[model samples]
Target: MTALIMLVFSLASLFMFPLMAQPLSLGLAIMISTLLMCSLASMMLSSWYGYILFLIYVGGLLVMFAYVAALSPNTLFGSGSPLLFFSALLVPLSLILYLYPLKDFSLMTVLSDYSGFMYLKSYGSELISPDSMSILIGLGTILLLNLIVVVKICYYQHASLRPFNEV
Candidate 1:
């Protein structure tokens, strides 16, 4: 259920990009909403420690999003800004940190291995091309990560909650 919601929001974010007259604002909103929803669901379903870490992660995302949104194209730090680039870095970083507690190296390795291939197609494209392949890759990565997390949570929950009769 949570995975579905995350997937929906991620797809929405991708579609929203092309329609954004103010890309920064729209991107910020979509990012914040995505982070907020993920964190909220994690808090409700995971341990307290997980909730705390999720909150911190979401906070950092919000700060970075705001920073990117504040810079003007003419400002010293503005044109061809690295803020979005940095935010992209955060996606995989947060996934690694969040899943580290699970100690599921197989899942992490799979995600990491595919991460480069997932975005590599964009490197060959011309800068002026209106195709938002990078955005699609970013969204896909987030959805994949969310699915892994949800599966991990469900597996553990089922194991821990099993009744003595079932055991």
Candidate 2:
């Protein structure tokens, strides 16, 4: 199934994280993995959700790329070990997947049915329904806590992330 292939590619890309030596390479790897994940999400859920998720990830990655480009020195890319390793790992994974088959792994079956289509349509609304108010409140509280923590950290006069003032 497409989802299985995406999952395998995502895992393979993630495995390269530890092998990355440069900030740029790491960022590139992260972007690739995020893309695969978003594609998988699109297949399993709604396309709109995956599109939004990918946009958010791209925004974050842009910020990260800017920071790394500014703070890190330009370094030549390392040898092709990562690619070789990735290819090596992918072959075995593909072999295993081919050898051991899975049943009903594709979301196309669910999407093909009218009830399933309706369920998917209502899935978004269910999240914010009255019954899930507690979950929303909890998420809000967590975000508030995170904001407070970030503000506290950034408020320090000598914080590295603080904006520079023109002398």
Clash pairs (backbone) in predicted model 2: none
Cα lDDT of model 1 by residue, 41-152, tens digit: 3432234533564566567556644544443221222343333544564566446545543222233235335665445334533212233333334435555543443343
Q: How far is candidate 2 from the true structure (C-alpha RMSD, Å)?
A: 8.4
Give, for candidate 2, the lowest lDDT window spanning 10 residues.
Answer: 145-154
What TM value does model 2 have? 0.64
Instruction: State how far residue 155 of model 1 sits from its true place (Å).
Output: 44
Estimated TM-score for each candidate: 0.31, 0.64
**What is the C-alpha lDDT profile of model 2 across 70-158, one tens digit per residue?**
55445679999999888888987777866774443333444446474466366586334443343334334433433343343234563
Candidate 1: worst-modelled 10 consecutive residues by lDDT = 72-81
lDDT for each candidate structure: 0.43, 0.62
Q: Report the Cα RMSD per candidate.
A: 21.6, 8.4
